[model samples]
Target: MTAWTMSDTGRSAAGGLPAGETAAQLVHRRLRDDIVSMRRRPGDVIFEKEIALEARVSRTPVREALLRLADEKLIEIVPKSGTMVARIPAEILPEIIVARAALEAVTVRAAAESARGSDIAGLRAIIERQRETLATGDIDGFHATDEVMHRAIAEAGRLPGLWSMIVQIKVQLDRYRRLTLPQPHRMERALAEHEAIIDAIAGRDAETAAAAMDRHLDGLRVSLAPIRDLNPDYFSGDVGAVYDRWAGEMA
Candidate 1:
């Protein structure tokens, strides 16, 4: 029998849940992080009973959390077949990149116009943290800092809503990206691209910042083909299958 409790996590520690966080909310956050970070893994079986036992929570909250994740498409619950983490959607990746690149360019341009010296410094700090994570070969840690770098630019522009929207749309992209990070010189190249964006923003060059952001995001769109070829099972089938699944859901 497992003796560990949910309090072991920082947010829901023995001290108590943060503000309005319920057990369901806490469970949802943990499971979502596991899914997005690829700790749970694509197509891996996810038993609610096991998760509830590990969290020491009642099945009600666990059910609620799983339902929420299903809504996010992080986990797909099949009729009579149980649930598994959703595979990355290769067909929609480029569409997502196009949308994200446009929105991100807006944010970086705004950041160039509005960012103070302190904001630039904060972004530099995040990149520096990424530098450390890369040196240690810590892919997840490096990716977390990469998120901070992008979100920092959005926040620096006072457009946190844009970042919030991006977060919602990027979870699928993230699963694919985590795979890309392990490729040769990938993390190093990403760090360099981040530096270029910061330089443009620090110089208060909005056009240059947007262009740099474009080049940065475009790299992912370009990497999709090679990475998908290498990890075919990690992605869903081509457009027809992807459309069928989504269409069935909406029916």
Candidate 2:
């Protein structure tokens, strides 16, 4: 188990946030959101003092948050090099996404077969919340609800290990998911996908549920297709070029 160094309560001392906000919490939220939302691009170095100044908080919380981010494999802490954002091997990401599709297919199938009336109700509630979030155009709320919806399916399957593994893998591709959402109709498409999967699971149609989940994962490739063409310079290293070469070879 990776030790989370920041104690639940000890995380608050570094910055002077409002009366209700602790420095640690503020730092953690800011850094985590920045990384997930791709605002802190991969390979960006985060200086505690700079973040503290920007956040209007103290260095303590920022340090604690950095520690936590390191644990999550979202950042690297080097004694002499400072803290750098994590840069996953972009070329291998496609393979990882394929693995994710396989795992989710199994998980959703199991969930569909095992889900009870109560479980179906729970999933419905999450869908309702997602609809509300969409109606309000609350990206954060929709993101949070998306998590709840996915977890609910895993829980219904009674597979904690599978759920944990999927989460770990999904986090690796989260940068893509975050970026995909900003594209036109991405949110609407995602909502439709979610509805299809949830409906299948609710109906206890294991095959249908698994197929829906697979389709959802496959959509990722479609989303990434245009990105590679429009922003070739933005992606670093040979990763982007390599992918382009792979496509040419396949063709």
Work out the TM-score per prediction.
Answer: 0.89, 0.75
Candidate 2 residues 84-130, lDDT tens each? 88764457667777788887788799899898889989998988898
For every model shown, the clashing-pair count is 0, 2
TM-score of 1: 0.89
lDDT of 1: 0.84
Candidate No. with top TM-score:
1
Instruction: Quantify all predictions' global Cα lDDT against the true fold.
Output: 0.84, 0.75
TM-score of 2: 0.75
List ranges where model 2 is wrong by over 4 Å.
1-30, 43-45, 52-73, 76-88, 230-234, 241-251
- lDDT by residue (1-251, candidate 1, tens digit) is 12235455444445466577787987898888888787878889888898877777788999999999999888999989999999987777766777899899999999999999999999999988999999999998999899989999999998999999998888888888888899999999999999999999999999999999998887886676677678777888684455455445434
